[model samples]
Target: MDPTPPVPHDLSPPRDVPLRLRPPRHRVDPRARRWWLLRALASAGAVTVVIGVVWWLWEPARPWLTAPLVLAALWTAARAVVEPRVRYAVHRWEATDLAVYGLTGWLVREWRVAPLSRVQTVDAVRGPLEQALGLATLRVTTASSSGAISIRGLDADLAAELAERLTAVTEQTPGDAT
Candidate 1:
């Protein structure tokens, strides 16, 4: 008198199933490129200045410092020119009822997904540079340390609205958010 239905013999997934996560649908605010550029240039300038000062002050170390100074200059040029564009092209984010998705990084990109059921908190952050550029970052925290996601370079208003929406959704969803 068994009532259970028989299991299907074919358990393999369909051949068309995607093997990797697709990129998030929305690109970050275009101004993010300028923000990143300014930040990179400022950092490079500071490091170059500091190294130049040390090289000047320490006469005995001048010969050894030459290599470092040259390397710093090269790095500065590359970062100021290349990193911002690459980062802008690579970074993207999207928020859906089921989950939040983010793609980040320039050198070693990472794709992240955080289900709404697991969301613990949503916060919008704007640093000095971001404020000046009218950009914000949305942080979605989850119970797992590695599950948290940050969607950077969003429009400030959009970020705030998204945060509020996410908060409301997470509240209504039936879960402990852990």
Candidate 2:
């Protein structure tokens, strides 16, 4: 057998020396439930429309409609409960490249990497729904829309902070003056 020391698996103070930070990355906020709420509200609206049509027309196919509407309601309600919104607290530092990245989402994961030279604008937007929830969405625009990334469902303050940070990073990068 070769004489080699085994690497430590547990790295607590009493155990082994910790190699990395306790938490590698930090979460921006609790998962947002606004999207599912919107979806559920839309689904409910559809069901209302269908019910109104059935009542107004008295169609023979009303029985079949019941099943489909019931199914849709169940699905929408379930999605509202199961899918939670996710946000990320970005920690972007310089490496060899003039680039930064933003990560967001929970059920649907998204990563956006854009070179500082390519970033055109950073904006924080809040819609009616977002306003109701006191949340905002930060959009990072670049020369290429296909490479764009949006960080959604953040508290207004955090979204503004992120937008400022991104803008600052872009402005400070060399060779970006125009």
Candidate 3:
């Protein structure tokens, strides 16, 4: 009997293997909840300012506009309080030896799979809000513009780890050199 083993043509999971391409089940840093609340409050504040302006400038229209504006303010507050948790629940990402897989989105579900060979750069980006929350967003760029994807809301350290690992794997992949 021949003892040679079969070579893997690609790093992709077997067709029969159910796509376990979900992000790890770990919860995000607790501070993300506060960050989300802050953003929501900021939005509601803006709406409040607008309502105030309308009330001062158009006294006669106040009755008609006030209710909607107040409702809007309430909705904004509700969104701020509820959306972060909903987002956290829906967000998941996993770094496999062969590829990076993630499911992200609240209303529009997006599934991402970027093979190591196709990864061009892995960036760990943090804005003021993210930095304050000790979080980072990982962006994976590929040769094709449409192939790029970002995994947001990861802990800063975890994002770094994923970026470093992806970069290492990408550098070693064949046919990736210019």
Candidate 4:
């Protein structure tokens, strides 16, 4: 007889499980669209200013650069208009007793789930822009290398509360969170 003890059914990994990820139920705050728009505009404006300066200083290259500058401006304008709305619609997150789920991205979507038992840390982050907009991102770090999940564009207060709740739940859950 083999010396190894039989693995418990509760702990055994599922075999040939089909992958089906449903979208998370909670949508990010609506203000996130405005924040994204402002950010996109600021970035595009900065690039345009730099290009304009170069075109003004370098007379000979102006003819060659004009096309690129125009193209860039058009692209930026289109993206600034469309991307924010798309991202706002697509980004959703939900936290439960068992797991945290997130769905993010516009063109390329990603869905993430982090079980409470494996969660190692919970943090709420606010950048200058996020602070200005009164928004925050809740980050859940798990034991796996690719297990970090960021639920962005949450109301600042809500994000903080969520982080605290997740921390408390993970602490009580039975696991090394390693």
**Position 19, candidate 2: lDDT:** 28
User: In model 4, which residue pairs have backbone atoms overlapping below 3 Å?
Assistant: none
How much RMSD separates candidate 4 from the native structure? 11.6
Q: Highest lDDT among the candidates is held by which one?
A: 1
Question: What shift in Å separates residue 88 of candidate 3 from its native position after superposition?
Answer: 1.1
Candidate 2's C-alpha runs over 4 A off are 1-24, 43-59, 85-100, 104-108, 145-147, 175-178
Give the local distance difference test score of model 3.
Answer: 0.71
- Model 1 earns a TM-score of 0.84
Give lDDT per model, in order: 0.81, 0.55, 0.71, 0.79
- TM-scores of the models, in the given order? 0.84, 0.62, 0.75, 0.84
lDDT of 1 by residue, 85-137 (tens): 89888898877666777999988998987777889999999999999999999
Q: Predictions ranked by TM-score, top down?
A: 1, 4, 3, 2
- What tens digits encode model 4's per-residue C-alpha lDDT throughout 1-178? 1132321212212345332355666788777887788787788867877887899899999999998888778867866898888998799887776778899988899898877888988999998889999999999999988868998888898888888878877888898988
In candidate 4, stretches whose alpha carbon ends up further than 4 angstroms from where it belongs are: 1-20
- The digit string of per-residue lDDT tens for model 3 on 1-178 reads 2232332223434556554455543445556666677777777767877887887799899889988888877788676867777777777666655676767766688877776677778999998888988988888887765666787877888788778877777887786722
Instruction: Tell me the deviation in Å of residue 32 in model 1.
Output: 0.5
Q: Candidate 4: TM-score?
A: 0.84
Off by more than 4 A, model 3: 1-27, 56-58, 144-147
